[model samples]
Target: MTAALVEEAVKKAAVAWINVGAGPARALWCLPVDGTLIVVSGPGEQTAPELPEATRATVRLRGDTGGLIVICETAVARIAPGSEDWAALAPQLAAKRLNASGTADDLVARWENDGCAIVRLTPATDQPAAAPALPDDAQAAPPRETPARVPVRRPFRLHRVRRR
Candidate 1:
């Protein structure tokens, strides 16, 4: 039952939250193909650090209402460039990628040249890690460390404009 649900969710959804190793879950655009979810990450693509080396990951799919639907563990496999799988799936991924910079063939060539990681996530379990009943606690994480910061003060106005 759970496996069927997972497959259904993957087929219907275009995005998923994936947590690899110790990193927090990151939302990624995904494509469902050959009964697995395909995600591209690296330069010029979504950021999923260490995913190529990861053997397993946790994937969460949300329903149309924007609520958590299911969380499941998946086995990770990296598809080699120029392989049969890559030749078949790359065009599809590029076509579905929103706001892509170039044509599907160009994107595929760039991905290969840039060493982008194209991984397939296959559901590994029939039972979900969490699902059906939502958890009470809000699963939010602290912002990642970065040099960027908000301005300390608002911009000074020469004079406040009075509104009618």
Candidate 2:
């Protein structure tokens, strides 16, 4: 899918889960590469479980600073198909085209093995886009042209009084 499509899917999914606090915070910035979602988290954030088959899936969160919590297949088999929350969330997930990938299957297996629920986000059709590349010798834009500073001299009268 196109970058625009992926971006749209992410935006929609983010909006749906932002209030619910159900997806990975750091993974929000992650993009799918080589059939896996690459997420970079701060030092203390929890590490994602190793995925099984590396399938495309929606990611979700349970806490603010706990790192990405869950990843799951796009299909909502375990989740009730058409509840109010599910209905509301489905479009966003659909937008991303979430689906089971080898990676996703692996994640599910890991979660099951660890006795953790697979966190899922709204599916997206396209994977997130790669970050813009920077030139090797890229330089900061030239500082904005500024007027030369003019020294101001204040004229003041000094009075000296002799005290007897």
Candidate 3:
């Protein structure tokens, strides 16, 4: 379980990045509203998984020393455009999206025009409640979807391609 103070710290964070042991981590400008972390991602915004493809994911965040800050187990829900949740979260995301193509008034319009989804991640509601307090150190390792695997690229490979 995430403590109230930790959650507040997350709320204050301008961006949160999560990777489910996949290709790469995605960072989004998010707002923690009502205990739910609301994130918007798509082609023109932050990159995120399609989300609807997975029901649950382990989200990890690190503190100043790169320590785990409550490895959150969350249920992923994709909020479609034009819904009440989208209506509420879109404006905030747009305001925070520094590179958005249009003015604030045109943000939602741009999303609808581009086809984006508002994904909300909440503490997993199904599983048994977690320990009330998380270790405030490196004792916690991020949960992985699968066992460890080999790296996709060579660790000591040259920085640039060799001349032909």
Give the best candidate by lDDT. Answer: 1
For each candidate in turn, give its C-alpha RMSD to the true structure in angstroms.
2.4, 19.0, 7.8
lDDT of all predictions, in order shown? 0.88, 0.35, 0.65
TM-score for all predictions?
0.89, 0.20, 0.65
lDDT of 1 at 154: 77
* Candidate 1 global CA lDDT score: 0.88
Runs in model 3 deviating more than 4 A are: 21-23, 64-67, 125-164
lDDT tens per residue, model 2, 1-164: 34443434444333221211232322233333223333321222233443222234444422234333222234222323345533443333333334534464454344334443223333444443222321244322454344775668976659865689
- Winner on lDDT between 1 and 3 is 1
Candidate with more favorable, higher lDDT: 2 or 3: 3
- Score candidate 3 by TM-score against the native: 0.65
Please identify which of the two predictions, 1 or 2, would achieve the higher lDDT against the true structure. Answer: 1
Candidate 1, residues 96-127, lDDT tens digits: the string is 98898879999999999999999999988657
Quote the positional error of residue 155 for candidate 2 in Å: 52
Ordered by TM-score, highest first, the candidates read 1, 3, 2
For the record, the alpha-carbon RMSD of candidate 2 to the native fold, in angstroms, is 19.0
What residue runs in model 1 are displaced by over 4 Å at the alpha carbon?
Answer: 130-134, 160-164
